[model samples]
Target: MVYVKRALPPRKDNGQRGRVFIRRAPLNRKLRPKQLLSRFTVLWVNTAGVPFSTAGFTCRASSTGGTLLATANFDNFGTAIFNTIPTPTARTLVIRTFDADDNLFRTRTVRSGISAFAIIG
Candidate 1:
């Protein structure tokens, strides 16, 4: 869970105008500390002959042991940003994609490195 403070908008109120506090819960429990989390980038797209877009796509990563690493949504550029606990050596991961309605659409095996990665799913 996290708390965010934002300035309150001006309105006719009996109390003084100040900041507002909003609380948000994380979608999933973090697997590692921020310092140990590495980001991976993946691009999901339509096939060469298929006319489609990767909009409203999201994905999650899991260890071969079946532990979920992290989840992220695709940006305008069709890149799914993933953060996970990385190993010193390359490791294999199971990455699954979902549609906007959270329906599972695709899955792929990825070999993870220390930096960002680009793979088509």
Candidate 2:
């Protein structure tokens, strides 16, 4: 599962506002037998198709599906932010799953092609 939360900008009357929360359901859609996931990786790329950063985590399967063995924060920008020039741009998210034996099982890529924007400042 993936979760993301961001603080909302301050309201005109209220100092700081609430937060925007997002969570992803378990990766069980169209799951196959013996296709247990052991590792998960997410890569963030710019509109130019240049990968800026990647985050990975280990998984442990259970009856419900799987749970991340380590704490993974999508907000951990690391070197990605410093390497990029901040501007109005779109990004792509690449999600990859691996099996227990370290074999990649599935891959999904989502592209936010610049049409969507939530302006805060």
Candidate 3:
């Protein structure tokens, strides 16, 4: 009988370090609106401010059903991405905002601003 052992490089004491190992896999395909029926995120960015308005904003499909999915708020003007587990049949995009008086306003759309918007495997 023979026993074999593999040794790894010793860890460096330096506080800064790079990734030791990473699995290199092809990027996953973006989920579409129909596919989002399962659970997907809605990312949006409002340049103006909360209680959003017609000033316009952009949105993207961040991810689907997992830890990587997180919601975002518009501090100034940028990008927002996230995911969720909404009802498949209830697939829709809702944009909402408020005014100085706390007046709430929003809009809904069947199309997402993502490049792929709604594509399915």
Candidate 4:
């Protein structure tokens, strides 16, 4: 078995001999969306029920009150991790998906707590 390690970003007191440390960022309570459902995962898939992994495919979510919430790009597995999702101003979110050419693929007015906003083709 093998595990990988990554170099932590340099700190103010870096180079104190060879000792290093990583401090986790303090959790922001306000950033956590109030989920009406227990859905904490989003998976983008195609019409055939397969994960869609097309390049340049992306999703942008904004609050109905005109606040940008999250913009996530699809990964190789057609999964997007919203590392910094914040609570939306309204219960509904305006989520838009774009294609490889940067053209609008779909627009979905979904609940702020919806599991996924998918663009299947």
Q: Per-residue CA lDDT of candidate 1, range 1-121, in tens?
A: 9999999988778675696878866879565544343556667655553323667878888889999878888876677766554443267878888889999887788775544444543
The better candidate by lDDT, 2 or 3, is 3
lDDT top scorer: 1
TM-score of each model, paired residue for residue: 0.53, 0.21, 0.25, 0.52
lDDT of 3 by residue, 3-120 (tens): 8888999987776566486666567866444543344433233444333222233333222222222233332333233344243424344433333354544333434333212211
Residue 18's lDDT within candidate 1 is: 90
Deviation in angstroms for 50 in model 4? 1.0
Compared with the true structure, model 3 gives a TM-score of: 0.25
Q: How much RMSD separates candidate 2 from the native structure?
A: 20.7
Give the per-residue lDDT of model 4 (tens digit) for 1-121.
8988989987685458787689765776345545653332346778888987756787777778878878888777777655565333336777777877889977777775455556565
Model 2 accuracy (lDDT, Cα): 0.34
> So what's the TM-score on candidate 2?
0.21
**Clash number by candidate, in order:** 0, 0, 8, 0
Pairs with backbone N, CA or C atoms under 3 Å apart (clashes), candidate 2: none
Off by over 4 Å in 2: 1-90, 113-121
Worst 10 residues of 1 by lDDT: 112-121
Which sections of candidate 4 miss by over 4 Å? 1-41, 86-90, 115-119
- The C-alpha lDDT values of all candidates are 0.69, 0.34, 0.37, 0.66
C-alpha positional error of residue 38 in candidate 4 after TM-score superposition, expressed in Å? 9.8
